[model samples]
Structures are given as structure tokens and as C-alpha cells.
Target chain A: MKRITIITGHYGSGKTEFSINYALDLMQQGKKTALVDLDIANVYFRSRERQAFLEEAGIEVHSNIYHSDISADLPAIAPSIRKVLENHTYHTVIDAGGNETGAMILNQFARHFLEEEHDMLYVVNANRPETRTLEGAMYHYHRICDESGLRISGLINNTHMLRETEAADVLKGYQLCHEISEKEGIPLIYSCCTEEILIKLKETDAMPVDFNPYRIRLYMRPSWLDR
Target chain B: MSEKQLMKGNEAFAEAAIRGGCRLYFGYPITPQNEIPEYMSRELDKVGGAFVQAESELAAVNMAYGGALTGKNVFLSSSSPGIALMQEGFSFMASAEIPMVILNVMRGGPGVGGIQPGQADYRQATRGGGNGDYHIPVYGPASIQETVNIIYDAVTLADRYRNPVIILADGMLGQMMEPIILPEARETVTEEEIRIQKPWALLGHQDKKERTVVKSLRLQPDDLENHNNKMHEKYIEMMEELPQYESYRLEDAEVVFVSFGSMSRIVREAMDHLAEQGIKAGMIRPISLWPFPNKAFDEISPKTKMVISAELSIGQMMDDVKCAVCGRFPVELLYRTGGMVPTPLEVVEKTKALLEVTK
Candidate 1:
């Protein structure tokens, strides 16, 4: 894993969930971590919603400039984010919003990203209408890259239909990501699978050797919402 | 069945509208629901549909009116304040007897309220926001899949009744993602189909038997009364045939909750928790707001003690719940307004207190 990791994907592609899990994973590894939410495109369900929870777990969280007003859709980026970007002591994960429009906010930090060792992982959920196909995934991948001025360093297959996820859904996303990795020559960094689905995959040894499995807990959605 | 696809509520609603044969959309961007217009602008053209980001909500609703006048399926979506601005257009469309579908991805309300999930527009949508004597059939979907279904069917419902239809979703629904099997796209209505079905439409008069005039100005009092009476007839028919709701565990219950849209989901979770604690709780989720689904109230068990309206706003839907209860039971309001959402635990706690007090 790189010192700085940037996660970007379609709106409902589980980037926020993955970013939260990734940040916690880094913290568990005894690394000082920070999660910066740069998702101004969405009005709700951003990583910032979990600020207090993440901070309680020893992970520094940064998000909208107006911290008090959670509902405000202001585009004002906090100046403190630049501090975390410059500090090499902490491993940082930047959770960009959905699509190229969401990733556009990252353009302001392009110089810092260029100077740092970062892995920009394009999360792909095959169940999303926009990224279900290789052509569709590539279109967004290229568009996000163009808008953010950052090339994707890896692909993450994080597909699921919320609680309805099955092994077939994960494998379908893996297939799409595999095709994209082969075509773009980008490494597939993670195959995010829920524990239950992972058990199902392991029953048949369906997962390939190269697919790095990343177990993700759905932190973005409340536990009460089964679907 | 086709593979289920994950989609945010806004984008899914937009896609469902397109598939529902809405070939023209006019909207102005606002928080939360902006994705509807964004999706429409990006995908509508590819499907041979037209999308216009109008100058304002008023302009967007007017554009929808203009498109619907030609007997084309038109879609319009906006948030709270934006919907408020489009009230005049809504009133005009209702008076003019135009058929179109409007989506209110509601947020905190009254003025330019916060950009968070809110159901304060319950009265605005179910009652009237514009001028006198109009009722738009409003469907409050609880989930993304339900939202898609309602939006898809709303296209036909609007056209069938020759009146505007409203799909009331909140920011939570607009931003949330869920798996949905989208219905097969409805074949777009051909020009010939339009001519045959909507003979009253104002297509070019050159080839028509009579010059068509679509206007709301019935200057004569009797004529206006007759026009209103005709429109009220459709509302009556909608009340009779279109009132839909879900009754969950109402067979034997001490307390019943009446909620709609996203708030109902939270209430459902609370019901489960209440059940664990030996508190018998039930729910009536109104899928249609305007028709009010008063029949569901009759299904409440005789054992039920009190009815509660749980909402994300300050007791807006409680009025309808009270009307439906009709003095048969005491109705109370449990709400979190100004962008605050009550957690399941909060709801459970409130229900317990309410039960104790009533006991």
C-alpha cells in the first residue's frame, strides 16, 4: 500500500465505504492515518458523516470547510487538508466523490499528488448502470482521470447490491475489473468482498490467486437498513 | 429476471422516467436532486429524448407545460424551494389539464431550507402550493426500487388522468443506493399514437379538424366552475382507484405508526426493535400522499391504542394522519426537523415513552 491512497468511483460504487474501511485498516496496522472527504458533488452519505466515529478510532478526519453545517453544499475546501497532504508522517486516504464531477475537487491538490507516492484506485461496481461494462468503466476511468488530472494507478473491484450481494455479483465485478486491468495495464489492487460472500467464494475456491481480497464492512449505511 | 443493478435514487428515478416514456425533461439544478437533471442531460439525448436545464424553476415548469401541451410525456424535478417557485406553473398546469410528472426530492423547507432529507413538503405536495382548488396525485416511495416503480407508473398515471403527478422523495432517498431490476423501456409513443390518443392536444392546427387551444383562462365564472368540476372529478377517481399503502403487522398492535417515504424505513426498523421489547407496534406506510390512502387507517387493529406520525419534519404528515383517523384514535407527532433525522433507537425510545404516557 502506498503512503497516500485516493479512492474514486461512480456515485453508488461504494467508494466512501471502501475508504472508511481502508482508513481503519491503516490505523489497525499502527500507522497514523487520515481520511479526507473531497466529495462536494453529493449532499449526503459522504465520508464526513463518520468524522466523530473515525476520529474516536484515532484516525484524523477532514471534510467540508463549514464543519458545523453538515447540510451545506458549499464548495469551500478546508486549508487544513493541505497540511495532511504535506505531512509525510501520516498515511492519508482521500475519498473523492462519484464520477468525474466529484473528482474535479481533487484538481486543486494536483501538485501535491504529483509530488507524492500515491495510489489512485478507481473503484468499480459492476452493478452500477454506468460501470457495468468494460466500455462504461473505461469511459468513467478516463473521464475521472481527465477531470482530476490524476492517472489511476490501480483498479478496485468493489461490487455488491448492498445486503443482496452474492458471490456471483462479486465475481461479475471481478471479471469486469480483470478485463479493465488487462486492457489498461493497471494492477488490480483489491477485490472488496464482504465476509459472508468471501466465505461463499472460498467454498469453491472461486477467487483467483492474483485477486487481493479486501474485506469491507459497510460503514456508510446504517445497520438497520438491510437493503 | 434481468440482473439487478445498483443505483442512487436520483439517477435511478431519472432512468426510470426515461424508460417510462418521458422523452422530454425540464429541470433546474438544486442540492440532492441535481443528479436527476445531470443524468437526464447526459443520457437523454442518446435515447432520443430532450433535456433542458431551464433558467429557473418557473421556467422549467413552464417548459414542461409547453411540452405536455403537444401530448408528449414531460418530466420535471426539483427540491423544496425550487418546487415552491414552480407552484404557479403547477397550478396553471392543473387548471389547463396538462399531463406531466413532477418529482420533488424534498429537503428542509419553508424557504431555502437546508440541503438534507425532509418531509415538510407533505402539505405542500398533498394539499396545494399554488392557487385555489387543485390536487396533484403524490406518491411517496419508501425505497429506491419503490421510487423507480412509482416514477415509471407515474408517467402513465398522469397521462391517464390528464393531471400532474408528484413523486415525493427526500434527500436520503435521492442519495442512497439500492439494487433494482429496471423494467423494460416502454416504447415511445409515436406521433400517430399521440394523434389518436390525445385528440385534445395542440399539435399544429393546419392538419387538424379544429384549432386546439390549451389555456387556463376560463374567464366566465360558470365556465371556470365547470372546468374545476371536471378536474375535481379526476381527483375523485384518483382517490377511489389510486390510493395505495402498505400495512405492516397491523393485525394485532397496541400502537400504529403512520409514515411515508424514507421516514417509513426508519419507523420499520423501530417497529422491529419495539417488537423485541414486547411492545406491539405496527405501521401504515402511505405510498400515495395526495389520495392519502385513508382506507389503510380502517385496517388498524381494534387493539391499537394510539397512532403516531413519524417524520423528518415538524409534523407535516400528521394532519393527513389525523384526518384519516377521524377521531377514532388519538394521533401524535414524533419528528426531527431542520435536517435532523431520528435514529431507530430514538424512535423506539419515543414510542416507549408515548406508550407509557397513554397507558
Candidate 2:
């Protein structure tokens, strides 16, 4: 794992959820962690909405420049993001917006990323309409790289249908990610699975032996929503 | 049916519209519902459909009107204030009996409210925002899947009645993600088929030697009255045939709650918590806001002591709830306005407090 981990994917691809989980995991491992939200395209369900909760858990959250109302969807980027990028002691996670348009904001910070030891991971959810196939996945993967001016270091298969995800779904996503990795020469870094789905996958022994799995919580969705 | 896939609500509505045979979409971008137009611009062309981002909400609605006048299925979507701007066009379409589908992914507002989820447009949608005494059939879906299903069917429903149909969703519904099995695509109707099916359509006058004039203006007072009566008859038929609602845990419920769209989903969770405490609470979720499903209220358990209207707006939907209850039970309002959403625990606590007072 590199000091700076950048997460990008299609809208509703679980990038925000994965970024939060990855940042917390680093914090739990006794590293100083900071999560920066660079999503200006979406007005709702961004990682910044959980700022107080994340800050309470000892993970510094840097988002809107004004630090205004969370509901205010301004395009301003916070300057503190630069501070986190400059500091070497902290393990930083950048949650970029969805698609090429969302990742376009990263171009402003391209120089810093180029100079630093960083890993840009493209999250893939096969259930999303845009990335269901190898061609579709490759299209988005290339578009994000082109727009962000940053090459993707690896792919993370985080496929799901929210709470309806089964072991078959994760395995199906793995197949797609494997094909992408084989075709592009990029590594399959992680296969994210919810705790329940992870247990099911283990019981069936469906995942590959070398498969790297990341556990995530659905923090964006409220508990009241059953599915 | 295709396999279930996760989709954001706005994108799902756009996909469902295309699958329902809508070949024309005209809309301006507005948050939380911007994905509708964004998806249409990218994907509509692949399916032999056309998408136009009009200069303003005013232009978007008129463009949809012109498109629908040609007998093509037309779709439009906007947020609260944008929908307000399109009211005049809606009135014209309603009076002209134009078939089209409109979506209101509402946000907080009397003016330019915050860009968060809100149901403040309930009165504007259910009642008339446009001039004249016209009522458009309004469908309030609680989930993304339900929104898709309603949008799919609304395309045909609009054509059948020759009136614009509205799908009422809040910012929460437009922004949330859920698993949905999309409906199969409908065969694109040929131009020749449309000409035959919609004889009143203004395609071209050269072939028939007669022109179809689509307008809302009636010069004579009697003529306007007759036209108004005809529209009223159609609304009566809608009330009789199109009212839809879901009654959850109503059997022997001591307190009944009424809500719709995103707010109802939160109220549902509150009901479960109340049940755990040995409190028998139930809900009447109105899926159709226009032909407001008053029938659902009749089935409320006689033991129900009070009826509460839970909403993201301050007592907007309560007016309709009061009419539905018809003084059979005491009615109350529980709400948070201007983009503030009441949590399930808040609803649970409110229900208990009301129950205590009634007891």
C-alpha cells in the first residue's frame, strides 16, 4: 500500500464507501490518516457528509473550501488537501468523483501526485451499467486516466447490488476484473466484499486463493433502508 | 426482465423512460435530477431517440410540448423551482390534451430553496400549479424500482388519457441508489405507426389535406366550459381507475400514519421500531397523489385513535390526509421543512408521544 491512495470509479460505484473504509483501516493500523473528498460533481451522498463522524474517529476530513453547509454544492476545493499531500507521515485517501468528469478535478493536483509515492485504484462495480463488460470497464478506466492525468496503478473489483449482493456477484466481478488486469497488465489489487458476503464466499471457497479482499461498511446509506 | 442491477434513482428514471418507448426528451439540468438529462444526452442517441438540453426550464417544457404534439412519446424532468417555471407549459399541455410525462425531483423551496431532498412540492404537484382547474395524474413512488415501474407505465398512461402525467419524487429519491430489475425495452414506434395511431397529431397537413391545430384557447365561454367539463370527466375516471396505495400493517393498528415517496420509507422504519415496543402502528402510503388514494384510508383499523401525516414539508400533504380521513379520526402533522429530514427515531418518538396523549 502506498502513502497516498486515490479511489475513482463510476457514479454509485461505491468509491466513497471504499475510500472511507480504506482510510479507517489505515487509522486502525496505527497510521496517521486523512481523507480528502474531491467530488464536486455530485451534490449528495459524498464522503464529506460524514465529516463529523470521521473526525470523531480520529481521521481528518478535508472537503469543501468554505467548510460551508454540507448541503451547499459548491465547486470550491479545499487548500488543506495540499497540506495532507505534502505531509509524508499521514496515509491519505483521495475520494474522487464519479466518471471522467468527476476525476477531471485531479488534473489540478497532477504534479503533486506525480512526485509522490501514490497508488491510483480504479474501483469497478460490474452491476453499474457503464462498467458491466470488459469493453465498458476499459472505456471508463482509460477515460479517468486521460482526464485525471494520472495512470491507474491497479483495479479494485467492488461489484455489488447493494444489500442484494451474493457470493456469485462478487465472483462475477472478479472474472471481469481479472480479464481487465490480463488485458491491460494492471494488477487486481482488491476485491471488496461485505462482511456477510465475505463469509459466504469463504464458505463456498469461491474466491481465488490469491484474491485480496477489502471489507466495507455501507456508511452512506441509512440503517432504515433495508435494501 | 433483465437481471437486477444497482442504479441511482435519476438514471433509473431516464432508462425506464427510454425502455417505455420515449424517443424524445427535453430538459434543463437541475440538481439532484441532473443525471436524468446527462444520461439521456449520452445514451438516447444509441436507441434512435433524440435529446435536447433546452436553454431554460420554460423552453424545455415547450419543446416537450412540441415534441409530444407530433405523436411521439416525450419526457421532461426538473427540480422544485424549475418545475415551478414549467407550470404554464403544463397548463397548456393539459388543456390541449397533449400526451407527455413530466418528473419533479423536488427540493426545498418556496423560492430558490436549498439543494437537498424535500417534499415541499406536494401541494403544487397534487393541486394545480398551473392555471385553470386541471388535475394531472401524479404518481409518488417510494423506491427506485417503484419509480422505474411507474415511469415505464406512465408513458402509455399519458397517451391513453391524452394528459400529461407527473411522477413526484423528492431529492432523496433522485439521489439514492437501489437494486432494480429494469423492464425490457419496448419496440420503437415507427413514424407511420404514430400517424395512424394518433390522428389528432400535427404531423403534416400536405397528405391529409387537413391540418390539426393543437391549442388551449377557446374563444367562446360555453366552449371553454364544455372543454373543462370533458377534462373533469377524465379526472373522475382517473380517480375511479388509477388510485394506488400500499397499506402496511393496518390490521388492528392503534395509530395510522400517512406519507408518500421518500418520507414514507423513513416512516416505514419508524413503524417497525414502534412495533418492537408493543405499539401497533400502521401506514397508508399513497402511490398516486392526484387521484389521492382515499380508498386506503377506509381500510384503516377502527381501533386507530389518531392519523398522522409524516413529510419532509411542514404539513403540505396533511391537507389531503385530512380530506381522506374525513373527520373519522383526529389528524396531526409531523414534519421537518427546508431540506431537513426527520430520522426514523424522531418519527418513532413522535408516534409514542402522540400515542401517550391520545391514551
Which candidate wins on lDDT? 2
B171 in model 1: Cα distance from truth in Å?
0.8
Q: Report lDDT (Cα) of residue B266, candidate 1.
A: 86
Model 1 vs. true fold: TM? 0.97
Among residues 3 or more apart in sequence or in different chains, the pairs in candidate 1 whose N, CA or C atoms overlap within 3 Å are: none
Candidate 1 overall lDDT versus native = 0.89
Instruction: For candidate 2, give the lDDT of residue A218.
Output: 82
Best by TM-score: 2
Which regions of candidate 2 fall more than 4 Å away from where they truly are? none
| Share of native interface contacts recovered by each model | 0.84, 0.84
Model 1 fnat value: 0.84
Q: Which ten residues in a row have the lowest lDDT in candidate 2 chain B?
A: B203-212
Pairs that collide in candidate 2 are: none
- Which DockQ values do the candidates obtain, in the order shown? 0.76, 0.77
Off by over 4 Å in 1: A114-116, B207-209
lDDT of 1 by residue, A4-91 (tens): 8999987778899999999999999999999998888777888888888999999998887885355677887788998889899989
Interface CA root-mean-square deviation for model 1:
1.5
